[model samples]
Target: MRADRLISILMMLQMEGRMTAAELARRLEVSERTIYRDMDALSISGVPVYADPGVGGGFVLPANYKMTIGGLTTAEIQAVFMHLAGGSFEQLGIGPPLRSALLKLLHALPDQSRRDAEWIQQRIYLDPESWSQDEKTAPYLQAAQQAIWEQHAVTMTYTSREGHELCLKLKPYGLVAKAGVWFLVGETEGNVRAFRLLRIDSLEGKQEERFVRPEDFDLQVFWQEWLEKYESR
Candidate 1:
């Protein structure tokens, strides 16, 4: 994720104007030495960054050099940030990187577009969790996310409705978040099913075993049918 970190540093400098090495190290959870190396990498890549020496000095990106997203209108910028308000990004352990990327986009937006996006962000609030339920945890969500994205199988022990611990090797096709809960939708036993990640006692990706996702599978259609059956039962 060095690339991501590098981009984050760039965006951070663009937004903050100046940041000390120690501050960047603490925020990024890396050593100060790593920050120095990253700065070198950035400079070598021709990014216009420099260190300010003396009292109250820090890494600086010039104020006059601005990056702007020219094609996107103010309305489009609003739409992007509005979709980002839901809490699902944090559920899958993607909150930090996702937010960082959003910041990058927000910084690149034109002055008026950025103002509108910030206005909507301040006014609107979204809570995806259900009022009737407590928060659910899915410790294996990161693993499931990796497996699904790489088209690999996952080995896990799933707690069945009958309270039996069943071993499974699942080829994850997609993951669905419903009512603030995460579900792993995958192929097992020659059938597609959804497994609640909380019920998974243990999970690991089978990196050596990859599978082709069914080309005809429609995740939305399947989820609708699955929901109907669950409700009827």
Candidate 2:
């Protein structure tokens, strides 16, 4: 645990440039004396960490200093890849980036750890799709995802379950994938709604007409509340 705490402290200083001993201690949930000892340990261990005395002084790393992904344990490396393998990132049209990142992580590992990680990948598997169900495809899923990421309004031609067609302008909030189905959650006419991705006949993102998202809007909370209300009815 001390090793982890020391690493975390280094990371904090790396990102923050400079931090007081009190600040570092508070962030690490340790005492100021412990922080001082940790700084001494880092300096002795060949890490370029130094403290400045007096006001506005704390630990500071060189401006150009950067930490590599090297210090990860073998088990940590395996866990990272395993979690990545469990996600449906590919279906969300981010397969290329995900694969690129995995390759980078793999390449960063030492030879022995790389082989161990590969072994773990070969032994454990993750299939995000549900069993014995027809594969669901949403033609507009990627567009909706992009719209949400860019905070843009989109004009969508949607058909309700009752077989009525409606064309509406929506301020895309987020996208949710459930049971192999994708849903687009957004705002239209001051009301938040969720539309089935499959039901969207056409989608055109209006990038020039962006809407400000509410500061308190949270995708997970919104999705949960919507699911609760839908299920209750």
Candidate 3:
């Protein structure tokens, strides 16, 4: 447990540049004194960790220092690469970038870990589409993703299940991809609703208006509750 905590501390400092002992303790769920001891251990072990005392002072590494993936075990490498094989990035329009990142991670691994990851990738297949069904991304998916990311309200020309065409102003809270289909979860006229991406005939002026996301909203929890309610019916 201490070993993992030490690695996490090193990673936090490396990524954040500088952090106070109190901040590290709060993030790591430990006491401030423990953070001081851990910092000492890192410095003594040739990690080049340093601390500055006083207000606005904290722990930092030299800007030129770089951390490597040498600490990862074989199982850890396999787990990471296996997740990459699951194939959700393609629907998000980032398949090429995801492949590039996988190659970089493979190159960074040790020889045996690289081999294990490759072997796992070959054996584990994630086919999200159903057999005999032609699955394709929704036409307005990219637009909805952009609107959700930028916190913009979109005017959508949508086709309802009963074949009615309606215009809606949507404050997009999040986008969910399930089993190769995408849904936009958001609010329409003060009522929370989910819009199937495929039902949108067109989207207009995604960035023309912006809205703040509610602080109390959580996508995963909301989805789970929705699933429970749907299943109970």
Candidate 4:
């Protein structure tokens, strides 16, 4: 955590040009003495850090001293890389791009920080079932994400547990993940419904019937409304 703070302080100086010790102390939630010690630690560790001892100067890293994702203080990179690898951010399809970005950022980090990043990568992981095994709604989930972004309409063949197959055409509002299941919540026949993705049989989208969503549409409110509908309370 101290290392992370050190990196953040350097980054702030790099971004903000300069800051006073009091300001840094407030931002860091530490004392001025602690800030001084941290500055000393950073300088001793080969970070091009310095403080101007005057009425105007506090602490600053070189203007060119930016925190490259490559130069991250290990834990930062691991947190991001793990999120990408874990399929949590799979919706973006930028997983490989993120990995490459992390590598580029790694190049800017100190040698010790780089080693820490590698160690963190090796230690932490997120292993969820592949989207393909979802059987029922994988395709629909993908479609819903697309529709949410593109403002398109989607049609799906949905089956209830009673084995009734119904064709639904709706304006896709949002895609939500709840309790390991994917739900596509949208307006169907003038009412909102949360359709289980896996239970959706055949899905397709048409580009012609697009409509503008209300500017006030709030996901949290929609979710609460959905819950109310579910309980019939």
Please state the error at residue 208 of candidate 3 in Å: 1.9
Task: Rank candidates by TM-score, best first.
Answer: 3, 2, 1, 4
Residue pairs with clashing backbones, model 2: none
Candidate 2 off by > 4 Å: 1-63, 131-134, 160-165
RMSD of each: 14.5, 5.4, 4.1, 9.0
Which model scores highest in TM-score? Answer: 3
List ranges where model 1 is wrong by over 4 Å.
1-76, 129-134
lDDT of each: 0.86, 0.85, 0.83, 0.75
Off by over 4 Å in 4: 1-78, 88-92, 108-113, 130-137, 220-233
Candidate 2 residue lDDT tens string, 34-153: 999988888899889887788888889888778886788877877788778844588787888999989888888878888888888889887777664444567887888888888989
lDDT, candidate 1, equals: 0.86
Model 1: lowest-lDDT 10 consecutive positions: 66-75
User: What's the TM-score of each model vs. the native?
Assistant: 0.62, 0.67, 0.73, 0.55
lDDT score, residue 146, model 3? 82
Model 2 is weakest, by summed lDDT over 10 consecutive residues, at 128-137
Residue 231 in candidate 1, Cα distance off native in Å: 2.4
Q: Which stretches of candidate 3 lie over 4 Å from their true place?
A: 12-62, 132-134, 157-166, 214-218
**Residue 8 alpha-carbon offset, candidate 1, angstroms:** 28
Q: How much is the lDDT of residue 225 in candidate 1? A: 93
Model 3 lDDT, residue 215, Cα: 77
